[model samples]
Target: MDATESTPILLREDLPGGIARLTLNAPGSLNALSDAMLAALAAEFGRLAGAPETRVVILRGAGRAFCAGHDLREMQAARAAPDGGRAAFADLFARCAAVMQAIPALPQPVIAEVHGIATAAGCQLVASCDMALAAGDARFGVNGVNIGLFCSTPMVALTRVVPRKAAFEMLTTGSFIDADRAAGLGLINRAVAPGRLEAETLALARQVADKLSGAVRIGKRLFYDQAQMGLAAAYDHAGAAMVENMLWRDTDEGICAFLEKRAPDWPR
Candidate 1:
């Protein structure tokens, strides 16, 4: 086993079939993001991003809740620190969002394997992922509004995942959306039975992994790049990307295989 398998932090990992399974390990804290947890998570993700053995990443939490968002105690403590000079709270939240964004920006596909409750920033993490899968019984939402705190940070990612009105409904109501409803809203990609969460999530991740790694990476990169462009420019951007994709060795092999009526052998 790798050393991470024995660590107690916000995330742990197991390398299997080129898939990096990152577990949100702080069950007692509901996988809350403490300074340590955040640092550990960033470090682990960084490692996986550069690791040749990593082709895909699966994110899930231990126990019930995926993540309870930030550890309030740590938040309060940071506010009390000497560096708490000004906007310390804001600064911390900014850092958190930055790290969260990095996960999806990585070349490999990221799948959020969610179960139980995912609330506040925890729900934000789910929305930020490339794809999300939740157990049919899973519940998700940004509940910060319930405590008089706006889920402003989460809104950045959540807005992109669901309709404006739908996102705002959860924000205003601080109510949970069921997994199936989440999928309908585009917040989750799939919803399986609670008992089948793990197997189902892994199955999806493997489906992605089984495809051409290079192609998936290029597609993922172009997806984010194209998403930010204006509609008219997006088509142009896609065309340019398509040209680049066609120039790749795998693309040529893929087309050749199709024409020849045989399965294509992909390169690593």
Candidate 2:
């Protein structure tokens, strides 16, 4: 269904070659991550975890921008409660963190199709993805410091993806980085002309979808698992993963096909 129809806050569209596109549709608030939007994303990612047919997922925002950040109005309204929104704020950030962590946890690779802007928690969302492609005019920042609040939550993912110095500069200065700058910072894979963003993103997604799904899934998991370990332990973990992957019939077929110069007839 289209964004205007079912689930206006979030829309899911499936395409050929197992690519699923999720659009954040709340353009009026610049696609802010409202409570409902976060819930929608969590539930959708839950479904995707069990959906083996979906090889890749593309997340984008509709209308003017990718996402501005949290819904400040919603957050402010919570302050009317007796506790001054402390409990509400805590829950909101916890939920947002869960949604961010779910991206790398999903079996399918996620590509952020960013345009216009991705700031604060929005920038964190891009960092959480396996990869990202932004429009040349797209912008990124963790500018919560500009309003007296530090972007501590977004900093978690930001620091992991970009260098510590670069992340610190953006976090402290509350400045925006252009798409090309973001690419250099390693927050995104690359930037393309605004008109070509979608095409280029889909091309990358399709290229990934063409790989052996089982191997890619293993590699994705291995990539993340090894990152948090000591060097020796990381190699041990990756070696075990390699052992499991090498036993897959498709992996054998891929190797044999390469030697024989024939297309692999991988089992479905």
Candidate achieving the largest TM-score: 2
Kindly give the stretch of ten consecutive residues in candidate 1 with the minimal lDDT sum: 1-10
* Local distance difference test scores for all models: 0.85, 0.94
Clashes of 1: 0
- Residue-wise lDDT of candidate 1 within 123-217, one digit each (tens)? 99999899999989989989888988899998889999899999999999999889989999999998998899889888887888878888888
The digit string of per-residue lDDT tens for model 2 on 1-268 reads 2244455689899999999999999988899999989999999999999999999999999999998989999999999989999999999999999999999999999999999999999999999999999999999999999999999999999999999999999999999999999999999999999999999999999999999998889889989999999999999999888898889888899999999999998754
